[model samples]
Target: MKIAELGADGTEQAYDAMRQLRPHLTSAGFVRLVNEVQRPQGYRLVASWDALSGRVVAAAGFRVQHMLAHGPVLQVDDLSTIPAARGQGHASRLLAWLEREARFLGCAQLHLTAGTHRYDAHRLYLRHGFAIRSFQLSRQL
Candidate 1:
C-alpha cells in the first residue's frame, strides 16, 4: 500500500473511494467543487493506493489553518476507507502520515470531527490518543 497525494490523474480513483463515504457528492459536481473551492483554499486530497490492484482504498481530505485559539493546526475534514478496505490499517496509516505532516508544518494541534453515532470511529480516535475537548455545533441557514 502506498499513500500519495491526489493529482490530476488520480481524480477518478480518489473519487471512487471517497464517494462511498460522501455519497452526497456527485462526480461532476465533485470535480467542479474541488477545482473551484477546495484547491484554492489549500485543501489536499490524499489516498492509500494498492499498487498491485491499481485502486485507491482509502482517502483523506485535509488542510492546515492558523487560528488564534490553536495557533497552527492540521484539520482533517474527511477520512474514509472503503467498507471492504476497513480493518486493514489503511486509515491508521494515513492518519499517522497526516500527524507527521502536521509536525513538519509546525502545527500545534490536529483536529477532526466524527458523528455522534459513529461509535467505531470514536473508538479509533481514542485509540490514536485523541481526547474530546469540545463539541461542535452547527445550524443550517
Candidate 2:
C-alpha cells in the first residue's frame, strides 16, 4: 500500500475513485472543479494505491486554513474509499497521513463533517478520536 499526494498525473485515477463517494459530479467537471477549489481554497488531493494492483482505491480532498474557532486546521472536505476497497484500512491510513501532514504544517486541529446518515463513517471518526462537538446546519441558497 502506498499513499501519495495526487497531482495532475493522478487526476483521472483519483476522479474515478472519488466519484464513488460523490456521484453528483460528472467526469467532465471533476477536474475543473478541483482546480477552481485549489486556487482560492488551498485545496489538495491525496490517494492511496494498492501495493500489488497499483490502483487508487481511496481519495481525500482537504485544505489547511485558520479560523477563529481553530487557529490553523486541516479540514477534510471529502474522504472516500471505493466500496470494494472498504475495511482495508485505506481511509484509516489516509487519515493518519493527514494527521501527520497537519502537524507538520503547524495545524492545531483536523475537522470534517459527515452526513448524519453515514453511521459507519461516524464510527470510524469516533475511533480516530473525533468528538461530535457541534452540528453543521445548512440550507440551499
Candidate 3:
C-alpha cells in the first residue's frame, strides 16, 4: 500500500473511502467542501491505496494550524477505511503518513476526535500514541 496526499487533481477519488466515515456527504459536497471551503482554510486530504487493486482503501483529511492551547498542531478532521479493507493496516498506514506530514510541517501536536461509540477507532488511536485528553461536547443548532 502507498500513502500520499491527494492534490486537487486527485481529490475526487477520495470520496468513496471517506464516505465510509462521513456517510451523509454527497460526492459533490465532499469535493466542494475539500476544494472550496476547506482547502482555502489549509485543509488537505490523504489516502492509503492498495498497490494490487490501485484502489483507495483509507482516507484522512487534516490541516496544520495554530490553536491558542496547542500552538502548532496538525488536526485530522476525518479518517476512514472502506469496511472491506479494515484491520489490514490501511488505517495505520494513513495515520503514520499523517504523522510524517505533521512533523514535516513543524507541528507540535496531532489531533483528532472519535465518537464515543467508536471503540475500535479509539483502540487504534491509543495504539498510535494518542491519549484521551478531554471530552468533546457539541450542540446542534
Candidate 4:
C-alpha cells in the first residue's frame, strides 16, 4: 500500500474512502471541503491505495494547529478505511505516516477524536500509544 498526500487531481480518488467515514457527504461537497474549508487551514488528505487495483482503501484528513492546550500538534480530523480493507494495517500505516509527518513538521504531538462507540477505532488508537485525554464535547448551532 502506498500512503501519500493527495492533491486536487487525486481528490476524486479519495472520495470513496472518505465516504466510508462521512456517509452524508456528497462527492462535490467533500471536494469543496478539501479545497476550500480544509485547504485554507492547511489541512491535508492522506490516503492508502491498493497497489494492484489502484484504489484508495483508506484515508485520513488532518491539519496542524496551534492550540492553547496542546500548542502545535497534528490533529487528524477524520480517519477511516473501506470495510473490505480493514485489518490489513492500512489505518495503522496511515497513523505511522502521520506520526512521521508530525515529527518532521516539529509538532509536539499527534491528536484525533473518535466517537465513544467506536471500539475498534479506540483500540487502534490505544495500540498506537494514544490515550484518552479528555472527553470531547460538541453542540450544534
Candidate 4 per-residue lDDT, tens place, 1-141, comes to 899999877877888988988999999999988898778889889999998888999999999999998789999999999999899999999999999999999999999999888999999999999989789999999
- Candidate 4 residues lying further than 4 Å off, grouped into runs, are none
TM-scores, one per candidate: 0.94, 0.94, 0.96, 0.96
Q: By the lDDT metric, which is better: model 1 or model 4?
A: 4
lDDT of 2 at 108: 99
Candidate 1 lDDT, 5-109, residue by residue in tens: 887545666777778768999987777777678878988888998666878999888999999999999999888888888888889989999999999999999
- lDDT by candidate, in order shown: 0.86, 0.89, 0.91, 0.92
Candidate 3 ranges beyond 4 A from true positions? none
Q: Against the true structure, what is every candidate's RMSD?
A: 1.3, 1.2, 0.9, 0.9
Q: Candidate 2, residue 125: CA error in Å?
A: 0.6
Off by over 4 Å in 2: none
Against the true structure, whose lDDT is highest?
4
Q: What is the alpha-carbon lDDT for the whole of candidate 1?
A: 0.86
Worst 10 residues of 3 by lDDT: 1-10
For residue 117, model 1's alpha carbon misses the true position, in angstroms, by 1.7
In candidate 1, residue 111 scores what lDDT? Answer: 96
lDDT of 4: 0.92
Q: How should the candidates be ordered by lDDT, best one leading?
A: 4, 3, 2, 1
